[model samples]
Target: MANIQDSAQQLEEAIRNSDEFQNLKQAYETVMADEVAKKMFEDFRNTQIELQEKQMQGQEITEEEIEKARKVVETVQQHDQISKLMEQEQNLNVLINDISKTITKPLEELYGAQEQ
Candidate 1:
């Protein structure tokens, strides 16, 4: 229904204006402002994506690749701005997950499914 579309848009705007989203944006900007932190964060993210892609493609992940990813994560975790950014990201993910569960309640009710 058109009303549902409008409600969805309102939810989107609310999410965009949420504290979690704002904090995540600020933290991301802070990390990007520092060249070293940005590079380290990018490398870490790329390593994660590579591993996830391999997993999704049913390809074997080499021990060397795992070790490399671990090292990249460690290095990135040592950077304050990047660490802050990662924390904010986690917070935002939690908010999104909560919102998803809330929105899916009708389906759960229809199916008589117990809340997880």
Candidate 2:
């Protein structure tokens, strides 16, 4: 059991020191463009939902209705793009957390062992 724990800690340290993990952590932290994209997507998705609901409720739509729907479609496209970005962010977050735990677990174990 002690050997198993030590091996796991070494493996975690190795990944945290790896170039790929370091690069990903940097990129995820520095990227600000995703914020704008996410906001735009939310706005579009909300509009699409509202317009679709109104159309479904037998609201009398005129020429303005067509324009509104078209706008909603445009927003839907933007939302799709944003959703993709959000998915990427989610994936990166999970990856980062996993890697961080691996990197720090040894230190945590040491502290815990000392306290015991």
Summarize candidate 2's per-residue lDDT along 4-113 as a digit string, tens digits: 68887887787677765675565444433568654665666676677678789977667886796677556645554554545555665787788678769989999989
Lowest-scoring 10 consecutive residues by lDDT in candidate 1? 107-116
Evaluated with lDDT, which candidate comes out highest?
A: 1
Q: Residue 112 in candidate 2 has what lDDT?
A: 88
Worst-scoring 10-residue span by lDDT in model 2: 24-33
Cα-based TM-score, every candidate: 0.92, 0.36
What are the lDDT scores of the predictions, listed in order?
0.91, 0.65
Per residue, candidate 1 scores C-alpha lDDT tens digits across 1-116 of 56988999999999999999999999999888888888888899889998999999999999999899989988888888888999999999999999999999999798886555
The TM-score that candidate 1 achieves is: 0.92
Pairs that collide in candidate 1 are none
Candidate 1 stretches with Cα past 4 Å from truth are 113-116
Note the residue pairs that clash in candidate 2: none
